[model samples]
Target: MNAPEFKKLPGVLAFQRGLVITDALFFNVLKDSQTPVMVVRHGIRGTQNVNKDGDAEKSTAANAKRQEVSNIQTTDTAKLEEEAQALAVRFGLRFLDLKDVLFACAPASTDANDLVRNYRDSVTGFIERAKTSPGLDEVAQRFARNIANGRWLWRNRTIARQVEVHVSVNGTPLASFDALATPLNHFDNITDAERQVAAYIADGLRGDDDAGLDIEARLDFGVRGALEVFPSQNYVEDKPRGFARPLYCLGSPERAGSRNGIEFESTRTMGHAALRDQKIGNALRTIDTWYPSYAEHGRPLPVEPNGASLEAQEFFRDRKTSAFEFARRLNTLDPASPEGMFMIASLIRGGVFSGGKE
Candidate 1:
């Protein structure tokens, strides 16, 4: 008789992200005072240039035709006050118990029940393995180093003359670091104090305490004078005609103005230029140097199941290194290995991975 067909993965499986990051709010710092940096509107005359999708002659003809029409419009701009000497970005970080990582799992058939059970058992085993292995510790250190290096500051980090990062837990100061001194390209050369910070975060991830972790990070940029600060940009599909650029701000939504019969809402009431929690989280998890092409890439990408780098427009991992494949063969993987650590890290990062076999 033929052997029974092997069951596929569960039809519905999902895991919530273990790491919790709050939105980073922007502030203009002057001595002992802090004020919200407001995003204001700026009107300017700009040249119109539209490139066509064909050969050079076709593109040149299209551009020349579009140049006949004026494209001057208003844009959004954010900057520190003239007296402000620095920019301060503050955000909160928290981690959930990895032991309770599974958010959902629904079996479509009796045969699939075995697959579900195996996955659940694997999660428990992996957690125990992580406790004994250095997998969790290494991942935690990379995150901590990212925080200490002020990598989340993005473009602001390049403009700053000096950068200072402060970490606090539950309103109590834990440690502060000179963000500039920390290397941005690698995680191996971290200082002793940074290691201590990583230990605290690792303990929280391991579910060592029930009090729950409430960590906050503040990055202070010494710019010496007023300068333009970068904030998350809003992706508006149907933006108003003249309003070409809209920045993300923390505030109540209200009608800011209208251009060419289109009305747009403004988030400038609260007057805080800020970065989204998603952006900050992405920066913190930029520790995926285990991808097959890391030797050629040199820099690390964010910890993603598919090794997706949106900025670079590339997928660095194949099916063998993907989270789905790792989960399928969890029993065979050593938690201390790079692939094993990557899978665990992806669990912490979290997302739905339901097989659509139903």
Candidate 2:
């Protein structure tokens, strides 16, 4: 019998344990793919208290200090880890210990977004170190180039080398199929104007349609004229009835170059369909979660009618997926998603404060 194809995806999309991702957007991916959620957690790192750098044997006191610095309740951490492991086992996904992939080359930093920063740095570092391995050097080189050009700086890109497909029915795991996964840049070669157009659409923004044209003829002409070259790929064009494909279809690189990559197209397409089915409210909900400050305004930025304090509102907002997921999906094309507007507001605010105090 032929071995099952594994998914080598760019990244695993896990539900942040405490955050409430919109039911519409969150369930959309789940409803479509029907894949088991792969929970992730990082390992302990040493600070002044411990020497986790090398294989040096530290004193008992150091170990105690490291545990103390973890700031995590052992009972809670162990329970969470146990639950995640159990889920993997129940779903029949090989228990993948990703500590090596996460921290093998992480740099110590004091940034507020340290986990994300370290993850990016570690992935790049791992790619560099794994250059001698087959089929990795080229990927590393391309990734480095993309980063230098800020291709993924605004978006969430994934990197998965090992993946398994488990068939589930009614949310119950049934059968497991092995697969491989990897990173792909679907829109790296698109012109800037085209990207901008996709960005606008993905942000749930609409413009006056002209006859059969989606955006105004003048705006469309301006964008096309600036491009100098038109994309001939059928996938790049709008579908019949004048709607564009969801970002997932156009953003994934066509050439994953692996046997599993071939399977990815179908899976990705299904995911796109799921996302496309989501209502615009999903995106609005995410935006609302991210920028509660705008709540003072109405309609465009809805705040609860309750007379909640600013700090209370913020605390509640932070519990939503907007806190982390937006930063991950910031640059990706999701024509129906709201990250574009949120990111734009953030950028504009940053610029406004660049020359002065907030």
Whole-model lDDT per candidate: 0.75, 0.24
RMSD of each: 4.6, 27.5
Evaluate model 1: give its lDDT: 0.75
Candidate with top lDDT is 1
Clashes of 1: 0
- Give the TM-score of each candidate: 0.86, 0.19
lDDT of 2 by residue, 69-121 (tens): 53321110111111121111111111111112222222223322344443344
lDDT over C-alpha atoms for residue 305 of model 1: 84
lDDT, model 1, position 145: 90
lDDT of 1 by residue, 1-358 (tens): 1112223456778889987777888887877888888877667777666654546466533334553556676677788888887777888887777887889977766444366777677677777888677988888888889988888888878776778888877677777878778887787876787887788778878887533333333444544556788888888875666666878888864455665455644333434788888898898889888899988989999988899999899998887788877776666678779988898789889998776553
